[model samples]
Target: MIINTTHHNTEHKQIIADLIGSPFSLLQKFKMKGVGSKRMIIDKVSPNMQSMMNKVSDINYANIELRPKGILVMINQGLKNFTWIIPYYQLTIYKVNGSSLHAQGRFVHFKNNKTFKENKKFFDKLLDEKVRYDMLFAMPQGI
Candidate 1:
């Protein structure tokens, strides 16, 4: 779900928390080292997501925050802030010329540039967390 987070609306907050789980506690944040991604340059976005990055600027950027059960991709377009909520099971990542995150028939591609290179470690952590989350529901092979 994409929501305009420009204001601190209680309803939006509740929905986000319910969908991705709440933000990590201080201890969890410290233990995890960090739960956020370095800023990334946006190269492209699915048609439906175009509006979120419509404002012309020197660069369109986004960042991701990891939650217990999912991830939030926050995008800023001028004064408006939008977040794309994607649960672990619904997330799909692909690395082509650049990296693209896809979910719910929508996708956002990040340019494979300097900023992206700086996020190598964060991406690794993200994939690790996703795998860890997936294991919790893994069925027995012989079942």
Candidate 2:
């Protein structure tokens, strides 16, 4: 999702992309039947993400959106310690598999990349909605 090239921060963008790319995303998909939505304070991170976060500032969570009592993520528009807000007008989001987004950075690979590949429908549903991507926050670097 290359939106604004004017300000670029590769590591920061990778962190946000990694979050979306990580199996953590599926944690929301198979949410317990009636569990309520709450803020996400992700302290323990995957090895891949931890390695990536090390290159940036101290990680934390923030609710940039005005959604009350909803889950929040720690990211900014390619900056340290900011909430990520996807710019729908300029960027297109995709779900790709593997440890991170595809090298080309268009499609998101989700096959065999989730905590539970047992459910193929979840996988298909993710890809099927490419046209209606969730407003994933796109963080441009060099802020």
What TM-score fits each model? 0.95, 0.24
**Candidate 2, poorest ten consecutive residues by summed lDDT:** 63-72
Candidate 1, after superposition: displacement of residue 73 in Å?
Answer: 0.3
For each candidate, what is the lDDT? 0.92, 0.33
- For 1-143, candidate 1 gives per-residue lDDT tens digits of 99999888999889988998999999999999999999999999999998888565658889999999999999988888899999999999998987999999999999999999989889998999999999999997984
User: Number of the top candidate by lDDT?
Assistant: 1
Candidate 2 lDDT by residue in tens digits, 50-85: 432335565332222211112113332235443332
Instruction: Note each model's CA RMSD in angstroms.
Output: 1.2, 14.0
Candidate 2: global Cα-lDDT?
A: 0.33
